[model samples]
Target chain A: MSVVSDRVTALVPSQWWQRSHELLSRVFEDDRRLLALCLTPALALYVLVAILPMVWAFNLSLYEVSTLNPVWEWTGPGRLLDIVASGTFQAAFGRSLVFGFGSVAFQIVVGVSLALLVNREFKGAVLARALALLPYMVPAVAIGMVGQFMLNAQYGIINLVLIRVGILNNPVAFLGLPETAMATVMVVGSWKFAVFVTLLTLARLQSIPENFYEGATMCGANAYQKFRDVTLPRIKNVILIAALLRTLWMFNKFDIIYIMTRGGPGETTTTIPLHAYEVAFNQYRLGEAAGIAALMFVFLALWSIVYFRVARPEEEVRVA
Target chain B: MTDIQVDTLRKEFSSDGGEIVAVDDVSFTVEDGEFVCIVGPSGCGKTTLLRCIAGLEHPTSGEITLGGEAVTDVPPQNRNLAFVFQDITLYPHMKVWENIAYPLKLDGVGADTRYERAQEVADTIQIGELLDKYPGELSGGQQQRVAIGRSIIRSPRAYLLDEPMSDLDAKLKKEMRVELQRIQQQVGGTMVYVTHDQEEAMTLSDRMIVMDDGEIQQFGSPQRVYHEPNNVFVSQFIGSPEINLLPATCRDGATVAVDDTDWRVDTGVDADSVPESVTLGFRPRHTTVERTADPDGIGGEVALVEAVGDENILYIDSEVGELRAVADIEQNPIEEGDSVAIGVERAYLFDAETGETVATSRRHGDRSEDQVEA
Candidate 1:
């Protein structure tokens, strides 16, 4: 009985050999390992420039760092709690939500309207479509400077036109005022992103089958009925995907807002990204900045999961 | 039910190359509850004519009256005509029942009634089990049945079927032909069917119109069209294996010379009335095969024999031209290369210049003879 058991045991691979074989096969068959080998240097550079700094900022957020001493001390979540309870951070957070949602709504409405206008064949449609995308292509810094010059209270073109037309007795201080600063940011953001939405909606519109419309017509559906029954349902999934993508992109937008409002005359246009930058570099409160960075990371991660769930159908079809 | 009358309809399309006349001066009338089958070759404007009747297309010059009211500007939905396209244009997204009930729903019929009617039609077409299945999930024949049911449920002024069974397999097509005829009879609705298959036209139509090059060649009962073609084209286009047209010179009243051989025909044309040069058209079944070595009889060497179950088609190479003769399978086992004589019992004499029948008087006499024989 012992000899037979020994013989059966001998047929099985030894533990060390099995482990080595598995390791080798895993290295051979694993796609992630292959990808990592190809992209390791670029990924490392990205981590160093972007991700590692974010991590360092998060670590510092848990510590009390003074710019004068250039030394840090562990403070845990106390600073984060204090910042959350403060009025300034709360106002900034509230304003960011308004800015994001307001801009996105405006962009979607205007963009869809523009897309519908150019969807049909018309005279000069090509030229009009090209011109519509020009605003999105302008450099963010240049747009900001130009906007500031145009809206300048003293002698800006907008003020000059208003004064000359007798619409205003005096030049309006547009950007300097609290009520108008956030509105200005939203308008600027919408101007930059509306073109993106238009392009996306146009592409989706073009992909709808012409036969569906013909079928609707044959079924005695009028124009509005056809759009409601056929066109809307057919493009619903694409619109959802476009909206989700735009949401993510708009949520993290920094350059347009920073260049335009610089966190506003009051903190009216200070989004989470602008707030983080101010805390870290401007105030030199690395620890608090790191905490804010980590919070922003969590918010973006939640958003990404929601976006993936919403946009999965489009991605799946593209993969197929 | 309303009768349809199309008066001198004409339609021309402006193509990139030039103008194309799709339908030229076509005129026909479908009496109430009549089944008219339009038979033509592909691209011969049969479908274009049906579309005009359905109000899917407007004639460039002409008027269509339904129930004595001009319907030139009426839309398809208002025309009360249901069309079954050749491609089985069932809505892929809709279930079989939904597709059938679509017309009822469009007319704002109640759900309970539409559902009951859809079920009845589904059962009629033997697609009751597939009522809940989307069109994409159904087979080609099932989809075609659904399309037919959709048209039938409307009970419109007329049902226009454009080669609806052309996409089905041979066995299915034969089955559907019988089913369509049965349904048309049961419904007692005006039906205008279009097909290139003469056999289908013969089986389904109360009256069949043979068209060619956007022109109506002949229109009459299928039996009349088959037995008495108005021109050589109708005679050739309407029969399987096609009718044999042999070049002949009318030598006298009772005879025509086919090549060097003098074949006796019962054309009944007087010597003066017979054209000098004419075409002798006879169907394959009309040409009888005899084991004769007579020099005066038309002679041919058998080229091939096609045994089609009940009959044998003998392809013979004659001096007049190649001819086919259908014979009983049990008799006349003439093999290839065998010399034989083919005799014409009755043949059509068509004027070579105009292709019009020169032997109409003979056809009239034959009809009376046939009646007396019956």
Candidate 2:
């Protein structure tokens, strides 16, 4: 006991250990007194809200948890297999992957291009940047509302323009058609979130040293070559991080698409979140919804690992 | 080798309120294969002048000629002049190999040739093993070498180095000084170097251009400029511990009355051209001090004795206020609070009113005629 106390005391700074070193640390041996005191309130809330729910849902996946039916039937893990094999869940999973990745890809490309273009000084640059930020700053629900009006089949401005231009004899059903519903929602989502990537890329771009460009100029590089050699390499790291964040946000995105196309003209854009919602609320199959949510959690965890490993966005960037 | 000349070059910049003339009608010429240094205090337009010579800056109303062709209107790319900036501006992204090869790649060179030339330049700079490392991984000095390597990969008309050694430690700076001199000798171009360090200017330059207030005070060989300063500013600026100035008047054709002493003036000033009032300038090495009360010399008291490794500098208080003198530590030892007598052996006289040189001590050994009537 004496040896342990002496070692513990040695670990602390001498000045601090010199004063008030005994009573405060007697708790280290059976430190549960203070540990339990410090850990009670926050731990209670987390367990009740987070841990308990997740554990219950995992256990609930093995039984029939129904709201309308009174009888509880033990189905074991077969419930999860049933949810996975359902055609609607499969379509929702595939559609979520397409909407999440496809929109985020276009967002990255457009975002980085705009960031590079606006990084330079010119007349009205500040005003133009502020104007470009309006689309991203607007609420996503409002943007979806506006997108529905414009993408309407009959009298929408898009169809009106196409009709006026005489390119199409008939107005295309952008939201009602299964083929174009997912793509329309993707275009709208990318339009709304592209500013996030632009801001991130631009911040990193501005941090790059001006002397690098001057050195390139001295080496006889033109404006375009300077961008290719110096600017692109410096900002690509932040673009990787921005793309990852956007993809994660879009993967579980439900509200914007739900308001715009509502699982789209026969489930063309029913993402994982929407499917989980329909199962829990409409069908009242609580156990199947839990299973679907659990699967999504697994897939997201695997995705995050693979994406971070592949991107490795921690490229060396000089501070000065 | 290239013959570069600036015909009354000037540069101006507009600030918030008005135009600021950075280089005020500066003109000089760099001979082929000559190493010239432009040295001045900060904000004295030495770097601006070098930038103009590199065609990075456009002159306000002047012309620059390279190889007997007017290149004032030529862009820097067309001028074919290379510049090494003060800061080591290596690309932080590329490896040392690609950074050195980037310039050749921009000129549309093939990948194989670019790789070969980059490796050769990397070997010249002695960074072969570190070629695969990014600049962020290199030390400040290594990055500086990469910058120089990038500049020297191509044979530009002339190399303009802008205080490229200012960012090194003292010992490292000395080492890199030798490295730079060796590289310059090997490359053998008309290199125009800019530095505010007069010691560096003196050591590295074949011909030095001393500037102040956007004007050239003196342009000559380092030996000639150090021994015979053309004006009081040049005299005080070119040396450490500073030159001492004494107020004097030309009493007659062959003598000058300085303070309470009348001394024979043997400076090369012709008797007919000698001005009435002058300031006598002498270097610390020229001022000899004796630790005794000698009637023939001005009496002084030693205020401080500073030992500077190889020599000692004595700060003596006399009728001229504080005067600095140097002594060889091996021959004569000095101490504080010693009564001393001061005498100047070599003196440079300048016209007090015009601030121009009226006479210089005869060290050139070329001007044999003594216009001093004695």
Model 2 chain A scores worst on lDDT over the 10 consecutive residues at A311-320
Superposed on all Cα atoms, the candidates' RMSDs to the truth, in angstroms, are 10.0, 7.2
Output the worst ten-in-a-row residue range by lDDT, candidate 1 chain B.
B365-374
lDDT of 2: 0.83
lDDT of 1 by residue, A25-101 (tens): 88779999978877999998999999888778778788988788777788887888887887867776777678777
Checking candidate 2 for backbone clashes, the offending pairs are: none
TM-score of 1: 0.76
**Tens digits of lDDT, candidate 2, A137-232:** 799899899898998877799989988899979999888998889999999878878988888887888787776787788899888998888887
Q: Over 4 Å off in model 1, which ranges?
A: A1-215, A255-269, A273-320, B108-113, B258-274, B290-301, B317-322, B360-374
Cα deviation at B84, candidate 2, in Å, is 1.8
- DockQ for every prediction shown: 0.14, 0.36
- Indicate the residue-level lDDT of B37 in model 1: 94
